[model samples]
Target chain A: MIQKILYNFKKYKFLLQQLVSRDFKVKYKRSVLGILWSLLYPILMMAVLAIVFTNVFKFSTPGVNYLVYLIIGLVIFNYFSEASNLAMSSIVSNFSLINKVYMPKYVFPLSKCLFVGINFLLTLIPLYVVIIVSGTELNIYHLLLPYVFICLFMFTLGMGLLLATISVFLRDMFYIYGIIQTMWLYLTPVMYDISMIPENFQTLFKLNPLYQFINFARSIILYKNIPTIGQWAGCGVSAVVVLIFGIYIFRKKQDKFIYYV
Target chain B: MKKETMIKINDVSMRFNLGIEKEFSLKQWFVNIFNPRKFKKEKQEFWALKNINFEIKTGEVIGFIGSNGAGKSTLLKIVAGVMKPTKGSIETYGNICPMIELGAGFDMQLTARENIYLNGAILGYSKDLLDSKFDEIIAFSELEEFLDVPVQNFSSGMIARLAFSIATIVDPEILIVDEILAVGDIAFQAKSEAKMMEMITGGTTVLYVSHSLEAIKKLCSKVVWLEKGNIKEIGNTKDICDKYENYTIKHMAGNYDI
Candidate 1:
C-alpha cells in the first residue's frame, strides 16, 4: 500500500500542485486582500473572542496569556472545521472531471486538505504575532509546534476523507456536519479554560480528539514546555487511527462513486 | 509481421442500480432500515454493458456505432479507466488519452492561460512539458490575445478549441475519442478531423465512438455495432456501417419493436 501511494504521488505530483494552487487562487480571486486575508482573518477572530471571553465571560488561564491561548485553540480548531468542510464536498463538486477522465479520485479530497493546510500554516503567523504582542515569552519548545501541526493535519485529512466519502452517499451530511461542528466548538475549551469544565466530565472532554490536539499545541506554545510522552501518544494514535480508517473507507467506496456522482 | 494487441476487453459488464430513491439522507437511511418491503421495491437493476469482449491490435482504429442508450459512452468510459466493469476486466498497453469531454477540468473562474496549465497538469503533463508546449498550444488554439481572460467569458467554441489543442498536444499509444470531433466551427471541425487523421495514420491505436457514419467509414477500418448494451455485429467498417444504417432505417419505419 505504501509503495502504491508513493508511486501515485510521484505520478500525479504535477496535478496535485496545480490543484492546490488553483484552490488558493480561486478562494481569494475577487477579494481585495487576496492572500492577506488568511493572515488577518484569524487575528481578527481571536481579538473578538479574546475581548468577549475576558471581559464578558471572565475566562482566564493562570499563567498563560489568554490572547495567545485563544489564538492557538482557534487556529487549530478552525483548520479542522474549515478543511473538513471543504474536503467533504471535494469529490461531489468535481464530478464533471471525475466522469470524463481517469485520474485518482482521492486527489480531490487530498488536494482540499493540502489547500487548507497551507492556509492553516499561514494562520500560524497571526498566532505568533499574538504571542509576541501579548508579551508571552518565546522558548525553544516552540520549534516543536510543527509536530502538533502535522498531527492536526493528519487528523483533519482523515476526517475530510471520511466526510467526503459519506457526503457522496448522503447529501444531508453537509448540514449535519455544520451542527456537529458548532456543538464540537462549544465542547472544546477554545475560549474557556479546561479548568472551567467539571472535574468528572473533564476526562470525557479530553477524549475528544481535537481536545488532545489543542492541548498539545498549548503545552509547546503557551506553557513553553515539551509535550509529555502521554500527550505524544494521544495525538499520534488519534491521528494515525483516523487517517487509516479514512483511507480504508475512502478506497472501499471510491469505485462506487462514479456510479452515484 | 503480426501486430501486437494494444487493448483487450474481457467479458466486461456494467450494472447500475436504478433505485427509486437515487439519493438518501442519513435520517432516511436509518428510518428505512426496518422497512424491508420498501427497500426491496426500490431496487431495479440496469445493465449498461453486458458481457462486452473485444480487442484492438496496435494501430487499429475501431469505431463504436449505436443508437441512443446503447452503452457507447459507458463502454468508452470503462475503456478509459474512468469506470470499472462489474464482472470482467480490461487490459491496455501504453498511455491512453481520453478526450471524453472537452474542457472537463477547466475552472471557468481561472484565466485561459492558467487553465491551460491546470488542464495540462490534470492530463498528466509536467510543468516543464507544458512550458515547452505552451506557445504551440496557444498558437493552435488561436486565442493568444484572450489568454488572460477567464474561461467563463469565452464562447463554448473557444473552450473546445483550447481543450482540443491541449489534449492532442501529445500523441499517446491509445486515444479514446467520444463525439468530440464535431467541435467549434466548420473550419475548426475540419482542422480537428485532419489532426485526428494525422494521429491515426501515425500509428496510434484509436477507439472512436461517433454517430457520423461518414467519419467512421473514413477513419475506422473496423466497427463494432452495439444495440441495447449488446454487440449486434462486429466486422469490417463498411459491412457493419451498412448493416447499422439498414437497422436504423428499419427501426425508424416502425417495423422494428425498438
Candidate 2:
C-alpha cells in the first residue's frame, strides 16, 4: 500500500497539474478578465461586504476589523467549499484515469486538496498585503501561519476524500451538496463574526469543526493569538477522524468502483 | 525440477445475466435488488466462462480465437485481474499489462502527447521507460504534427494506434490484448502485427484475442477455442481454429442466424 501510494503520488502530480491547468483554462478561457478574476472576485466581494456590514448593519467581530475578519473566514471557507465541491466529482470526472491505474483511490481527493490548496495560497497573498496596509501589528508569532495552514490542509483533505467517496455510490450527492454548501456558508459565520451570535448560540457553532478552525485562524491573523490547546485538540481530532473514515470507505469500495463507473 | 508457471487460470468461471426476468413483471427491479447479484440477469444463467483451466509456461504466446461472446475476453479479463471470476482461482507471477479493452483508459480530452504519458503510466510503463521510448512511440504512431491536439479531434485510427503503442511499453510479463487490430488501415495493421510478433519473440507472454483466423493461424503456436463459456478445444492454432470455425458454422446454420 505504501509503494502504491508513493507511486500514485508521483503519477497523480502530472494529472493534478492537468486538472488545475484545465480548471483554470476552462474557467477563464472565455471570461474577458481571465486569471485576474481570481483576485478580483473575492477582493471585490470583500470590499462590498466590508462596507455594507460595518457601516450599514454596524457588524464587527470583536477586536478585528470587518475586512480582516471577512478575509479570514472567506479564505478558510473557500478551502472547504472548493475542496468538497471539486471532490464531489473528482473521481467521476477523472474516470478515464482512475479506471486505468491500480493505485490508491484516496489520491483523487488528495489531488483536489492540492489544486485547491494552490488557490487558497493565491488568495492569501493579497490578504497578507491588506494586513500590512491595515497596520494591524498582529504578532511575531504570525510565523505560525504555516502550522495553521497544515491544520486546514488536513481538514480539506479529510472532507475531500469523504465527499469523493460518497459521490461515487450516490449520484444525488452533488445536488445535495449544492444546497448544503449554500446553507453551510451561512450557518458557519463566514460573512458575519461568530461573536455576533447570541450568547446561547455559541455552543451550536462549536459543533461545526470548520467554525472552530476559522476562529483559530482569525485569532492568529487578527489577534496575534495562537489557538489554545483545546482549540487545536478539537480541530485535530475532527480532521483525523474524517481522514480515517474516508480512507476506510475508499479502500472498501475501491475495487467495486469500476462497476459503478 | 519444478517449472515456473507464469500464468494460471484454474476452474475460473464468469457468469452474466441477459437482464431478462422470468415473470417479465415491472416490479422485478425492486425484487432483484433485494436478491441482488444472486439472481441472474435473465431467468436463464448464461456462462461467459465456466470451469476454465489453463496454464501458460513462461515466455509462451497463446492466442485465444473464438466467435463473439465465446468467453475469450472474459478469460483475458480474469487473467489480467481486470474483473473477478464467479468461482475459481487465477494467479500470476508478475505484473500484467492488460489491454482487455483497447481504448479503455484513453482520455479523448487530452492531447496525444499528454495522453501518451498518461496512458503509458496506466499501462504499466514506468516514467523512465516512457522517456526512453517517447519519441519512438510518437514516430511509430505517425501522430507527430497533431501530437499537441486533443485526442477527441483525432480519428479512430489515431486513437487505436495511440492505445496500442502505449500498451506495448513496460515489458509486462503478461500482455493481454483484445481485438485492437481491427482499427486503422491495412498498413497500420501490418505494422501493429509486426510489433506484436516482436513482443512475442522477446519472451513477453501474449494472450491475444482476435476474430481473424488467418492471423491466429500465423501468429499463435498454441490456441484455446471457447464456446458458450467452455473450452471446446486447445491445441495447435490451425487445428483448434478449424474446429471452432466448423462449430460456429454448424451452430449458425442450426439456429437460423438467431
Candidate 3:
C-alpha cells in the first residue's frame, strides 16, 4: 500500500503541487491579509478561549501555563477540524474534473489534507509565539512535535478519505459531519484538562484517537516532556490503523463515485 | 509493414442503474434496510454500451456517428479510463488525452494565468513542460491582456478558447475529442479545427465524436455508426456516413424502422 501511494505521488507530483497551491490561492484570493490570516486566526481563537476559560470558567492547570496549554490544544484541534472538513467535501466538490479526467481519485482528498497541513504548519508560528510570550522553556523535546503532527495528519487524511467516499454516495454526510465535529470538539477536551474527567472514565476518553494526538502535542509543548514510548506507539498505531481502514474503504468505493457524484 | 494496434475494444459493455430510488441519503438507506422489497422493486438497468468491439491502428482517425443516446460519449469515456466497462475489457497503448468537456477543472475565481497552470496540470503536463509551452498557449488562446483577471469574468467563449489551447498543447498518442469543436466564434472554430487537423496529420490516432458530419468527413478516414448501444455499421467514412445520412432522412420522414 505504501509502495502504491509512493508511486502515485511520484507520478502525479506536479499535479499534486499545483492542486495544493491552487487550494492555497483560492482560499485567500479575496482576503486582504491573505496567508497571514492562517497565523492570526488561531492566535485570536486562543486568546478568546484562554480568557473565557480562565476568567469566566476559572479553569487552571497546576504547574503548567494555561496560555501555552490552550494555544497548543487550539492549534492542533483546529487543524484536525479544518483538514477533515475540507477533505470530506473534496471528492464531491471536484465532480466536474473527476468526470472528465483519469487521474487518481485519492488525489482530491489528499490535496485537501496537504493544503490544510501547510496552513497547520503556518499556525505553528503563532503557537511558538504563545509559548515564548508565556515564558515557557523551549526544550529538545519540542523538536519531537513533528512526529505527533505526522500521526495526526495520517489520522485526518484517513478520516477524510472515509468521509469523502461516504459524502459522494450520500450528501447528508456533510451536515451530519458538522454535528459530529461539534460533539467531538467538546468530548476531546480542547478547552479543559483530561484530568477534569472522573478517573473511571479517563480510559474511555483516551479511546478517542484525537485525545491521544492532542495529549501528545501538549506533552511536547506545554509540559516540556518527551512522550513515553507507549504514548508514541499509541499515536502511531491509531493513525496507521485509521489510515489503512480509510484507504481500504476509499479504494473499494472509489469506482462507484463517478456514478453517484 | 502493418502498423501496431493503438486500441482494441473486446466485447465491452456498460450498465447504469436508472432507478430514481437510489439510496442517496442516510435516512432513505435506513428506511430501505428495514424494507428490502422496496429496494428490490425500483431497479431499472440501462445498458449504455453493449458488445462493443473494434480496433484502431496507429495513426487512424476514427469518427463516431450516432443519435444523442448512442453511447458514443460513454465509449470514449471507457477508453479514456474515466469509467470502467461492466463486462469485457479494453486494451489501449500510448497516452490518451480526453477532451471530454472543456474547462471542467477550472476554478472560476482563479485568475486566467493561475488557471492555465492548474488546468495544464490536470491534463498531465509537468510544470517544466507548461513553463516552456506557456507562451504558445497564451498566444494561441489570445487572452494575454486578461492574464491577471479571474476566469469568472471571462466570457464562455474565452474560457473554451483557453481550455482548448491547453488541452491540445501536448500531442498524445490517442486524442479523444467529444463534440467540443463548436467553441468560440466562427473564426476561432476554424482556427481550432485547423489545429486539430495539424494534430491529425501529425500521426496522432484520433477518436472524434461530433454531430457535424462535415467535420467528420473532413477529419476521419473511418467511421463507426452506433445505434441504441450497438454498432449499426463500421466501415469507410464515405460509406457509413452515406448510409447514416440516408437512414436519418428516412427516419425523419415518419419511418420509425429502418
lDDT of 2 by residue, B103-195 (tens): 655666767887786666555556677889998888888888998888889988889988777776557777777754544789888898787
User: Model 1, stretches more than 4 Å misplaced?
Assistant: B26-31, B255-258
Writing each residue's lDDT as its tens digit, candidate 1 over B1-258 gives 368999999999999988835446666676568787777766778999999999999989999999989999999999899999999999999999887887879999999999999999888888988999999999988899999999999999999999999998987899988864757898888888788778767878888999999989988989999988998899999999998898789888886555
Q: Give the runs in model 2 whose Cα sits over 4 Å from its true position.
A: A1-41, A48-58, A96-103, B1-3, B10-51, B84-89, B102-110, B150-153, B180-186
Q: What local lDDT does model 3 show for residue B128?
A: 87
Q: What i-RMS does each candidate reach, in Å?
A: 1.5, 5.9, 1.5
C-alpha DockQ of every model: 0.74, 0.25, 0.71
TM-score chain B for all models. 0.93, 0.81, 0.93
* DockQ-based class of model 1: medium
Q: On a 0 to 1 TM-score scale, where does candidate 1 land against the true structure?
A: 0.96
What residue pairs clash in candidate 1, if any at all? none
> A98-211 in candidate 2: lDDT tens per residue?
555454456567767877787788888778877877777768777766766777777777777778777776667788889999998999988886667898988998878788
Per-candidate RMSD, Å: 1.8, 4.4, 1.9
- Give the Cα error of residue A143 in candidate 2, in Å: 2.6
Total colliding residue pairs, candidate 2: 2
The 10-residue segment of model 3 chain A with minimum total lDDT is A66-75
